[model samples]
Target: MIRCRQFYLGYPNSATVSHLLTWSHWIELLKIDDVLERSFYEQQTLLERWSVRELIQQKESALFLRLAASKDKAGVLQLATQGQQIEQPADLLRKPYIFEFLKIPEPYQIAETQLETLLCDHLQPFLLELGKGFTFVGRQYRITLNNRHYKVDLVFYHRILRCFVLIDLKINEVQHQDIGQVNMYFGYFAQEENIEGDNPPIGIILSRNKDELLIEYATYQMNSQLFVQKYQLYLPNQEDLRRELELTLREGTENASQSAKTLLDENDDT
Candidate 1:
């Protein structure tokens, strides 16, 4: 009662007051312990106009942590107020795009056809994994150039980003050739399908495992917007995600510290 009265007096705008007094809204905010994080979610709820279900999904998916963990260094203010802003190509990508919804056995070495079939079979869950604002275009979409035919595994139009995204499925570890092929796919889209209003197409190679060493060596000089992500057949354990999130946060802090020291050293040298 005291808190509510204080809240009423502390900020007197009716819109803010209504939001503060909403029991469900307060309940959602109470779910998080960190004050900054709670405030971020509150801002997201207001800006995104998320329903109760959407709020739960955001929490369960660890959306804030996942976005924060990216090398892009999006701060709390960005997460709170921006509401998943796509400032650049990298912002649209996740490190390990989760695909536990496919329901395939973890040990099963499934063929590419079967995997694609399963994705199309459960398209709704696939879109959720794909991220917000994706509309399915087709599976195995065909595009012909120079008297030859090429097939894209899965095609989607990201409504928010306003671009065509082409995904190729690989049932094995990602290789340099996978990047090459996806680049070609994007090239085809850029030439033929991408019209004036559309952004250059984005390509993703979804593989059973990501070969970090190979990816680093091959993609170091590559400028194309191609990404390779590993997919798991099972949903990751919630505890495991929490641990990973903590580690990522620590790593991000250390990286930022290192960057600041390097800048200071450079200034001293000059």
Candidate 2:
């Protein structure tokens, strides 16, 4: 169609010329109106080799918006050009991870055991949702210290980061004790499990709710790479995500402009 032709004509230097993507993938990507968003999908599809179905599903879930939410203008633009560059640990994280595949009903008051079971039952989709380079190691992995046995909810090895990812699932909001416990797990993994090439293990607490202030206080001055992220049982509202991304980018731009103006004003005073 005219739109498709215009897309190709507008971004002649795009990854569209590559043989990695098929016509079906292009058809799905063509639905995206934002050139930056479409370019991001195109680059990700080429890099990850996502099937047409997966491409459509990612688009529906607003993956780009979620990834762009925390990024500045340059980072957002880099996503369009380079897809996702997993050069560091934080790049592997997605805020408010989607778990619609779990198919849990209302009230959502499930026990931790039941929740872990559901995640194991739907492991494949969970891994995909967790993003790239994750391979499952075990569930209920046991760690012993001072004759006491402790079990971690889930364990995964991130090939890209070359580290172990320990996940602790909390049915409620994460508490201060939870952060301390995971940091303990990180110490165990770092000292006991890490091999010659392995980096220090990272710990994550996946909970229904997170108290930002609580987490900030809990993680203050901690040496470990620990994160507390919220997970929803349903897909996110794309419109809300879009608006949030816009607001975040606007704030980043304004902050950058303010900093530049302050520097210029100081120079003028000199």
Candidate 3:
């Protein structure tokens, strides 16, 4: 019986066993690779809430390049490792959202009221663009202080941020006064409307043109929750914007160094 068993388990049988084992190992590795790939895509989808089409669009748009341009090496690695997780649905919304849903033309020649109306019309998309946790409170919200009636262009509550966001739109260039005015609006909200758990209100002054230099100077002395940003009827070159942001950050570092030097010189003279 032993001799018969040895003959059955001959060289050909051993080779077949070895081949089967090799194929099984390959299949196992392939399964692991598939799981990792699926996890990556799933993560990205959650983070960006990217539709398959949108994901394709992002790839074509060089979204990774844009992200690399904007973020540091660590940030890029972190984003890559973590993948995309949409903590907020609003993060998925595009900024300066094209009102294509309204069948509006390329250059939307409309007044501020018209823009507000369009936003109201496409409320869902607008909220998405506004970012996570935005609930529209009102439009042209009126507030009277010191016998003067001032109207805020738009008011929103951000649940995640736990703050009120006051949006003021400007068709022209943003001015120093605009910053001050928004600062005041933030003050009013903080003093009057903000709930106990809410963070300080945020004021966004959006204009067709913005002077970064002026904004820097204006915000230097103020602690108010105000942010100034330029808005375009059509999306400007994202690369140009990224370049500008890099230059601005660089200039800030240079300015800080110069100020420190001046302070040291003054102290020495004293």
Candidate 4:
């Protein structure tokens, strides 16, 4: 019989452990590898009071690295413990969305329509990929302008963010035109469709690839409601992502350190 003797041996002070998290949370924490990663989950589980199933899903999806994509170590820790409170607009943008649940293979690209259909067929899993608090509003959501009708690829309302999310699909790498078009969509929704007291509609141009520089510049200069993100049809090699993630985190930390040192040096001279 396999016993969690190692687990108990590490945290022999049961009362201290019990004061922090329940036995179920400790069981979930035992699954993670790194001390920091386990700690993040443990803290999040205790704070969010996530059921065992939610903890398993978060771990399986690599939630640590997902939030870490945009945030620093302390920020990621705060998010895990305090929960995602969308204070800034950037809080809504999580990059490199994985659509492994789409069940589509590579080298066989599907059009926006087919992709929409597949997503509808696999709604539950897709919703998980779309993140929490998103309710499907319908595919091919239509609006009219200048006596012409147009339909968006997908639509969802984020309960937490409190905005209508307009999504347009692109099989190719995102272009400036795509940004412009989705911006138009955002404008249209904000101008015509939005009900009273609703936040302005947020637009996302989902594509396979994009000029990262262009995406940043375009989204920044354009309306704040516009965003560009990529989706992978197949599941990413998590091992590769994890390795690349370590390199990215290290680079980010070093860059922050250098910037801090430069600022302090400038202050000393001035």
Candidate 5:
């Protein structure tokens, strides 16, 4: 029988065992520590796939606090992880966004009949409002479908979205039929114009009045892509805008505090 010494009892690599065991306990403790704590380092390292240096930059920039400020936490997470992989990147939330199409120099008072002409005159700005990667295909595009003629107010092709955006300008209240009509337009565009990789065309109706309930029901049933936004000829009250900003700020702060507390609790339980 071979006599084994205490140091060489288990394995041939005695020095290797000593080296690994010396630090192994601390490493295991760290793994348990990470499991027991919701460290920002661990969360960010997993989520953002950040390098040590990038993690430092994110901390310096207060990225987590900024992310916590979002009204939609899921959307913020998606943005952080995927970086805005939207098929149709609409500016649905960008209030007071610049209306480049409406910019006209003073002393050049143009008639309402010349609205389309004026828009064409400053087509660049109009295209910008329509969103990036948009090209002016045509205005007053006439489509003959099902033995009926339909005239689209404005037609644009969005390169990034890889889809077409059909816009209908309305100076009055948006009716249920109006929504149906735009949805029909979307269907037509999807069937007739959309390429293989392109997303379904998006239809937008910019009207003076939009009925929330009506819009809700209209969009609920239809699989066709569409959005409706109310437009104002004049800017809103500055005081009202300021009050809204203040309220949003307060709400965001409160929500952030609550989220942090919840995270801390989960960590404690762990």
Candidate 6:
């Protein structure tokens, strides 16, 4: 009884969403200690309509850490307050997307085709993992150009972005050629596949490994919207991810202070 009162005291907004959340949901949320993280999960649960089990899964996967690790301090605060507003193409990205629902054991030696098949078989969970606004178009979607045929591993339409998202899966590390290939698909999609009212297509390369230096060199000054991210067959190490998020936050804080100092110096000079 005392704990319940303390929980309510900590979370004043709980009264507003009382109609939506059950005791089970509150129980799952109570496990969280960070106020910002608790608010994030609470808001996302309402937005995504996640069940108790799904909420548990997300918390275990360290969804907050995964999303916050890539953002600046303001972005992290927005996540806590607004719960993932997808206004830009970059907002759709999540680093090292998790696919533990596939139930595939690690040391992933499976073929790319097999991986695609597994994701398709577990389509519902995959879509949820992919984040919001993704509606699957087709698997092994074919693209024809000049009497030649190319198969895209997976295709999804983003309702919010109003664009087609093409995915290419790689069991091994991503290469320069892979980026060029996805970029070509993006061009083809922009010209041939997209109809009126459609935004330019974006491409994603999902691989077991990603060489950041290779991607940086390969995608330098590229015009198209293309992203390369790694996929984990198993759940991530939450402690490691938390440490990474903490480091990113500390760096962002330092950078923000440095920028403020620079601005003050400029003002003084003027």
Model 3: per-residue Cα lDDT over 40-100, one tens digit each: 3334545545444544434333334343344444444454556533343223223333333
Model 5 C-alpha lDDT per residue in residues 1-270, reported as the tens digit of each score:
122342244345755432322232323223322221214334444433444444443333333333333335445444444432334445322243333336556444444336566666778545533433678888888888979999888888877777788878766678888888888888788888888998888787876577889889878867546777755434344456435444655666789999999999999999
1-270 in candidate 1: lDDT tens per residue?
Answer: 755564455446756444433667667766676654666677766655666766776676666655555533345446655556665666677656666656567477778999899899989667765666789999999988789988899999987788898999988888887788788887788888888899988888888688789898888877567888776665445566556556765777899899999999999999
Which candidate's TM-score is highest? 6
Position 89, candidate 6: lDDT: 82
- Name the lDDT of candidate 5: 0.57
Q: TM-score, each model? A: 0.75, 0.90, 0.60, 0.80, 0.59, 0.91
lDDT of 5 at 25: 30
User: Where is model 3 more than 4 Å wrong at Cα?
Assistant: 1-44, 47-70, 83-108, 235-270
The backbone clash count of each candidate, in order, is 0, 0, 4, 0, 0, 0
Give the Cα RMSD of candidate 1.
Answer: 4.6
Model 5: lowest-lDDT 10 consecutive positions: 29-38
Looking at candidate 2, the ten consecutive residues that score lowest on lDDT are: 7-16
How well is each residue in 187-256 modelled by candidate 6, as lDDT tens digits?
Answer: 9999988999999998989988888999999999995489998888888898897787778778889999
Instruction: Provide the lDDT at 28 for model 1.
Output: 70
Regions of model 1 farther than 4 Å from truth? 1-26, 40-50, 72-77, 105-109, 237-270
Give the lDDT of residue 229 in candidate 6. Answer: 84
lDDT, each prediction: 0.72, 0.87, 0.59, 0.75, 0.57, 0.87
Better of 1 and 6 by lDDT: 6
What's the best-to-worst order under TM-score?
6, 2, 4, 1, 3, 5
lDDT tens digits by residue: candidate 2, 201-228:
9888999898999999989999547888
- Cα error of candidate 1 at position 78, Å: 2.8
- Model 4 spans with C-alpha error above 4 angstroms: 1-3, 6-26, 42-55, 216-220, 248-270
User: Model 2, clash count?
Assistant: 0
